[model samples]
Target: MKLTNKHFRIAEIMAAFFTGSQTEQDERDFEEWAKESDRHKAFVNRLLNPEEYEENRRALDKFQVEEAWSKMDKRIGDTKVRKLSSWRSVVRYAAVVLVLLSAGVYYWWNGEEVREEVPVLYQIAAGTTGARLTLGDGSVVDVLKDRAVELKEVDGTRIVTDSIGIDYSTRETVDTAEIMNTVQTLTGMEYMLTLSDGTKVFLNAETKLKFPTKFQKEERVVVLEGEAYFEVSKDVAHPFIVKTNGVEVKVLGTSFNLRSYSDENSIATTLVSGKVAMFAGENSEEIVPGEQAVYMKETGKMDVKPVDVTLYTAWHTGKFIFRNETLEEMMSYLARWYGVEYRFIDEGAKKLQIGARLDRYNNMNPIIEMLKKTGLVNITQVDNMLYISSTE
Candidate 1:
């Protein structure tokens, strides 16, 4: 059977189900469906749990997502998201973010059903359950996970991370207290930070960055952890510098990737555009787009390679594209985005590898079916831990 747009629409409906804050009619429909047969209930459960979907034999369990979304809605609260002036100029940007946020993206198809096997690594990930944030000045912003935000006037920088696009607005700073600051977020999350000099940054999960809200004269600098992507603004006088996990990247006006995950044994900096010379005590050189600077956290050695930029930025988009990415690397992305802990009980999980592109925003089982269709691995779940057994 073939996967059709109906499944896509149903998946979107389930996305709304997982995250409360649904519309009036939607709630009524959910109630009606709940009163229906047990099979209907089982199908929804299958949709919620990717692991259950892969087996095709697991029975339904009470949905936990109802409680998860309820907690998320309360955490987000009545705080309003600041609107970006730039978004006003964008073409039809309002529909995408606003519509999807309140009611999940939807597309209905009146067609036949298709039930197909998924690829082993092909699985659906649940939406972010929500996260807590600690600000530099002890302030806290409890952001509902998966929700987009546009925050401006932070020490004079226009810092925003939205679906329209990651935009860094140029700002003028007049104070010194805002100079040295920190931006921190919890696990299973990511953010975009636009600096005063119009440099754009994307911060990954469980990341902490100590940066100046405003740049000092002649140099723009910051310290990083976890991962981030920077689109540096052009400034001949003030050079942008990023220090992370013992590696420093210096770029005048360029785009690059910085990985400083403390748990991982390596810090990687990939250049997507422009040029930059890295400084790591005597062993470093300049790099440009398609080149990655990987520093081993354990051995303290650097290796540079040319890579496909799409693989690095795919998460920024809705799809995870893998042109031969490793099994652990792929699972890590899913873990962060899905807000699930990767407890690999199977030591042989490393032997499993796959190459595919998955739009995780949709259904997980359909993706699982797609993965199994690849015929590379078998999957099982027990006690909320996913065990991936490699076939090859």
Candidate 2:
């Protein structure tokens, strides 16, 4: 029988299901369709069986998976994008590769629990939700935990600390002198800061933001060392610029997220709303909402593309989201937030894709337990280091 577009779509859904990335509703739909007729069952069986669809598989060269994914992403839309929970699902056939890789099969998604067995592990301490404030004079103050203590006045800018966030609003524009202040968070900690110019920033764990206590008349520039989400206050006269390792993001009255981790390969600047211009070396690109600018560290080349802004900004909402992300990619975030070391026993395991969502503030024990439950990779802890290996 000649396969149509509908058959290809069903095959895609089947790949998602076997990889444990499909949603409960998707599973129900597939099951319902499977029970409808023997033809449907045979169709699904043909998809599941590698030999049946071998001739139909499209030839994809190295890195062509990303292109296929882009087409599939356009077809599926961002709403259905899910995080994989396991890496056990493997694709050996070329036809399955078209389905698997197009859906970002490196990230495994296990919708339901495969078994009731829980791995043996000690409860690890959760990350702290606190940050340290460095004044212009180089004095460090623990603001989150010690909110009651009176902080030293910085150029008459009152820094107020509440449970929700840290506010640095000036009653009057007293000092135009640029005195830089920094806020830093360690592993497993996050912070929210309101700048003197009313610009709000959310700093992620192991992140740092350095900004002026007072903004200059022409421009508002800040140096960032880690990941942060910015809500820039409208100042048409002054452009807000965030400078990181290889890129600079310029905005005016906009909200966006920038991630430039040292361990990561690229620096990603994701725009949530409004507009922003990203500059890397001589290259510059303007991106609007739902767009991201990725600056490759090695080549110093910047590429802008549309993205799901929510996934990039999920950290600000106290969540960690991985959509078609690899184990190495996910572990980099985990290592920073949990302050742990990761060693891969199998190199192939590092390339395994995973999709899942978990509370960022949760203890490492539960997170490790969930990964173990997927039965894709074995996670063992020795001191602060986590050893990950393919179960197969």
Candidate 3:
């Protein structure tokens, strides 16, 4: 049968169902369609049984069998048939079959070669929620997932930690002395923090933030060393200031994203709401909503320009939105979040610009596949390192 848009839609629904992301309506529609023909029911059964599917796939031509085995060995290891406990494993298994079926169906109907060849990518899990909290006394506490702990500072400030995040709003007593604390997230980790003044900070991977357990009466100051999105509590009396490197971001009540990684050549502060003033040396600029203040470390000059704030703030919301970004820049972001390293074999490929909006919470295979579909670069992974080269 000739493949049409309807077939593609059905394939999408089937894929969603297998991945356990299908909605109730989609499940109902799929069931209704499956009941129309025994062949459809058989296809669904085959998808449900991974062992049978693997057996049939191995019976294909020599090249297909070898490729399938290679991918399976690299991704799933030596175990050919085993019970999968997570939807992620199911996605891995079903994704291969779905891609092959879709391609084969199109080729059989249209008699055309597949338009693109997708490389088999090794699974690299996405970042998780975790961080290290260093108390004022230089004692360190590991903040992990699904564990609850209550910590009391020497000044009687109560800090609560849970699976969601760390909260510092609760206090047993107020003190004039501000006890400084720090939270650091390594690669493959992101975390959220609620300050004593109700300001919520979302920290990205390989980032560090140092703040006092209690803000001083005059000002709320925090030191950031990497990237963070700040929703400053509306406190007109005490202005909130974020100090990073040689620059300082001053705001009373505003939301913005600041990126001041030591490795990056420039520091970017994108205003999402309210107003923020970026100050570096003698240079100062007050950026309004939808504007970005980029400070070049080399020249000590600050430039303000309008930008799509979502592009910079999307990571706080668990998505990566890149537009016309170089391959080197994009890979740097991915490397930190995925806890993986990448090397460009073709140095010229570093300058290739690409745009993509991907979920930061999904497995890295889909993201790699999307990059491969761009057709400008080729990616291959060995262990945890990804090698990128130009397709040309």
Candidate 4:
């Protein structure tokens, strides 16, 4: 029989089953198709293990994406001269085209073959150096790596772009209307900023930092929306304060990592050096180095506990250190940096706990492969969305 779109859909259903992401109805449909006829069963088996079809496997291995796209374009241009055949032929042609476009020969066709190799070269990549800077005068600037532009000269302070991030060193501390500036990092992007007072801020993905172009004499305060690692400059007279999500971190000449994502249940502040005081409404708590303060957004309650500082600060170092994190928790962090959507098939899969350290800068595919290898969870990528289910 000629290949059709039905065949391609059946292949996808088999994939979902192997990945453990198949719904109850999908499992029933798959089983019905398998028992329908001997030809259907054989086709499904070949899709499950493409090594059974040597010609197709070899064709996949030889398929070069760039050449395939060029050839497809030429074919499309010449389609008027040569009328295409039946829908079955079109489906077969489309299948081959999709296989070439999906990257890698093995993963596109065969499921078991993917088990032996790492498919980390995914379409979704990690965050890079880019941020939106809103200057004091209500003007915005896009700050990216190697894109240098002079922002402005507030009073005597000159805000300019350097090789890495924005730099503001030479500023006159004159009271020419206190100028407030905001820098925001979009999803799949991060940035570094050096404030006028030499305080360095390393912003994480989907974070925003609002500060003055030049700080007042009494205090240095910045409002944070998401997550950031701050290396506050030493000023005995002027204390540095970070306000975020109804909580504030007060410090003087210290470093800390603060995570205040809106989706999270609590705002976590981990001190790396010196000390930090976390305040929420009427309650407040003091935490020292190696300690974390978790402030619940709903109840406005703060709890201080000892934590591994490295786990909280690893994002800036191009690493993700998860210490016994749930599958849902891990995927939530991954989704932000990689700019992908994820869903668990069941509640059990979401709660499955695992511990692994991965290179945050790497693509999404390998990380999913690694998670699958652990036998804790099974992962399947449908377009940019990742579907996860319990291996049990």
Q: lDDT of each prediction vs. the true structure? A: 0.56, 0.70, 0.78, 0.73
Model 1 bad stretches (over 4 Å): 1-125, 128-133, 144-173, 343-346
Worst 10 residues of 2 by lDDT: 107-116
User: For candidate 4, lDDT tens digit of each residue in 234-276?
Assistant: 9989999999888888999899999999879999999999988
Model 3: per-residue Cα lDDT over 29-118, one tens digit each: 888878988767766665556556454454333225354345445555455455443323444334434434312322111122223233
Q: Write down the TM-score of every candidate.
A: 0.60, 0.67, 0.70, 0.70
Candidate 4's TM-score = 0.70
**Who wins the lDDT comparison?**
3
After best superposition, candidate 1 residue 386: deviation in angstroms? 0.9
Sort every candidate by TM-score, greatest first: 4, 3, 2, 1
How well is each residue in 218-291 modelled by candidate 1, as lDDT tens digits? 77888887777788898988888888766788998888878778778887778888998877767686777899
Q: Tell me the spans in candidate 3 whose CA falls farther than 4 Å from its real position.
A: 1-121, 174-176
Model 2: per-residue Cα lDDT at residue 289:
92
TM-score of 1: 0.60
State in Å the error of residue 110, model 4: 24
lDDT, ranked from best to worst: 3, 4, 2, 1
The per-candidate count of clashes, in order, stands at 15, 15, 0, 5
